[model samples]
Target: MNVYSPNLELARMVLDSQPFSMYLGARLTAFGDGGATLELDIRDELRQQNGFVHGGVLSYAADNALTFAAGTVVGPAVLTAGYSIDYLRPARGEVLRAHAQVVRPGRTRVVCRCDLFTVDSEGNQTLCAVAQGTIAVAETALPEPVE
Candidate 1:
């Protein structure tokens, strides 16, 4: 599906401004009405003691991607209510990709599904985790930032 270009720009700007995403080296690759793709480079610091990417890292990516996907129709004011994920395999790859899509959309809440994959340097993708999340959309305008 073609991405809504404005939402894509907003997603990129949000990711770029997020301290956590910045520290994790996450990048917003694409975003549209109900979908978002986030990518992260695997680094030593992001791995568990066993050398696989950590679960927390995977969850973080999924959560943000979920929110971004919901944000496409909900605007920028959205927060995740909760999410659950199951890890299918240990992530061992050069990069991690979190692909999220809103499967159920509403005025106040949106449900999103995400698949976390590890992409090897050779570009092979292995499913590492799956997630489902509920996002709450703000029905009212958010307060402006104070100077």
Candidate 2:
């Protein structure tokens, strides 16, 4: 499959068009052919009762990064079919990053793996979560009345 990097304009468009992504404040940090990195600042809203970044927040970031990376290979019309995540450590930092790489690209499905890390004020990296997802290419356009 041909690989092409998405420009910042395209990345912003993708991020703005996605409703759930907007809700999570996901920002596209970098994008390449079959890879992408998303970032989110850990705020009080993202924390769980323990005062650490919630696992669900990490999962959402990872999943978003994986899906965006896969979309760079396939088109932007892909949707997540299945996803699984593993939490390794708690996130105790002020910022978080999710880096995703495309594992397998197919006509119907694209598989991606994402690694979520927390970056401390000292610029140290801590492995927080790992996620794998399969995105299916949309067969048809969404519901819209045609003229």
Candidate 3:
């Protein structure tokens, strides 16, 4: 089942190119043939009025993780076509981890699902959100935005 080999260094470099992800301190903790995990330390600035991790943050994690998972199977050039997420609980913890896996892999598109979890000081994880996304393969990397 391990048909694809993952390049952690390449993945890290790709993530580092993303300013938003770098600003959030999100790191690629794990990457494999058809799975990836992104994690970020929780900060007060990332919290909402309810003192829970903001939904936007969770969404970003899910989106990136899902796309990265698909990238494992479909190469590096890919974009998220669309995705849906469901919040299961308010997230409050020391770290947020998003784990994603490819459900189906094809030449042009890949389906991925992600589970967002909150990890407490004791290292217990609580699932707070779930997401599913479709990734579209690209022939080449997208052009950088004009500043």
Q: Evaluate all candidate structures by whole-model CA lDDT and list the values in order.
A: 0.88, 0.85, 0.93
- Residue-pair clashes per candidate: 0, 0, 0
Candidate 1, 72: how far from true, in Å? 1.2
Q: What digit string (tens of lDDT, one per residue) describes model 1 on residues 1-147?
A: 423244676568777877788899999998886789999999999999999999999999999989998887667778889999999999989999999998988878999999999999899999999999999987676554342
Q: Which candidate should be chosen as best, given lDDT against the real structure?
A: 3
Can you write out model 2's per-residue Cα lDDT over 1-147, one digit (the tens) per residue? 555546767766768777777777879988877898999888898899999999888888988888889888876777889899999988889789999999999989999999999999898989898999998988975443232
Pairs in steric clash, model 2: none
Clashing pairs in 1: none
Please give the distance, in angstroms, between residue 100's alpha carbon in candidate 1 and its true position after superposition: 0.3
Model 2, stretches more than 4 Å misplaced? Answer: 1-5, 141-147
**CA RMSD per model (angstroms):** 3.0, 3.1, 2.5
Instruction: TM-score each candidate.
Output: 0.91, 0.88, 0.93
Better of 1 and 2 by TM-score: 1
Minimal lDDT window, size 10, model 1: 1-10
Q: Write the per-residue lDDT of candidate 3 for residues 18-136, one digit (tens) a residue.
A: 98998999999998879999999999999999999999999999999999999888678889999999999999999999999999998889999999999999999999999999999
Residue 38 lDDT in candidate 3: 99
Evaluate candidate 1 by giving its C-alpha RMSD to the native, one decimal: 3.0
> Sort by lDDT, best first: what order?
3, 1, 2
